[model samples]
Each structure stands twice: as C-alpha cells, then as structure tokens.
Target: MSRTVFCRKYQEELEGLERAPYPGPIGENIYETISKKAWQDWLSHQTMLINEKHLNMMDASSREYLKQEMQKFFAGEDYDKAEGYVPPVEKE
Candidate 1:
C-alpha cells in the first residue's frame, strides 16, 4: 500500500510521494507534506513559468526567483504567473 499524507497544498489526506524529490530538508519536508499530485502540478506550472519568462536555470537570480515562487505556490499565496499567457483550447 502507498503512503498517505495530509497534503498541505490540498489540505486533505492523499497519496504521498515515494521519496524526497531532491536532497535536503526542503525535499524531506515536501515528502512529508506535499501530495504527488500537487508536486506534479507545480512541475507543470514551473515549466510554464520558465518558458514564458525565459528564465535561464544557470542564472542564480532565475533559480532564486523560482525558489521563491515555489514557496508561495505551496503556501497557497499569491505567486507569479506567466504574464500575457493564455491556455490553449481543447477540441471536443
């Protein structure tokens, strides 16, 4: 059986990640509190932010910006969005 966590993002008990996403305390914390679904959602959003904002991961500032955004995102607070971006419509 899979582990379940009281997901901070969803505020409900849900299936948890199999392991920490990366090394360090933050990863551990996420493994304990963040649901897999929430993590995946963040990844998609992160990619959109990177592409729309033209962020270079090699740049320290860009990485820091994403870090801050990640915190806000999980906290359910106001986070940066890709400006002037529109979602593509799906065909029936």
Candidate 2:
C-alpha cells in the first residue's frame, strides 16, 4: 500500500511519494510533506523554468535559483515562469 501525506501544495491529505526526491533534509522534508501529485506538478513546472531560462545545472547559481524556485512553487507562492512561453489556446 502507498503512503499518504497532508499535501502542502494542495492543502489536503493525498498519496505521498514512494521515496525522497534526493538525499538530505530537503529530500526528507519533501518525502514527509509533499504528495506524489504535487511533486509531479513541480517536475513539469521545473522543466518549463529550466527550458525557458536556459538554466545550466553545471552552474551552481542556476541550480541554486531552481532550488529557490522549487521552494516557492511548493509553498504556493509567486514563482518565476518560462520566458516567451504562451499557453496553448483552447479549441472550442
């Protein structure tokens, strides 16, 4: 059976991740509080940010920026978006 957690982003209880996303306090904290759904959402959003900003994981600053943005994204705060990205138009 899968575990459940009080999802921080959705503000409700939900199915939790199978394991920590990474090693360390941050990963532990995420494992304890973040739901799988929210984590998936973050992954998609993170991809957008990385692609939009042309971030280089090799650069410490870029990684740090993504870390900060990840925090904001989970906290339901204002987070940066990809540059020059347009939402797909809905078809009627």
**How many clashes does each candidate structure show, in the order listed?**
0, 0
Cα lDDT of model 2 by residue, 4-39, tens digit: 999999999999999999799999999999999999
Q: Cα lDDT for residue 30, model 1?
A: 91
Quote the lDDT for 63 in model 2: 91
Off by over 4 Å in 1: none
Q: Candidate 1, after superposition: displacement of residue 77 in Å?
A: 0.6
Q: Model 1, range 1-92, lDDT digits (tens) per residue?
A: 99999999999999999999968998999999999999998998999999999999999999999989988898899999988899778899
Give the residue spans of candidate 2 off by over 4 A: 87-92
lDDT of each: 0.93, 0.93
lDDT of 2 at 23: 93
Minimal lDDT window, size 10, model 2: 81-90
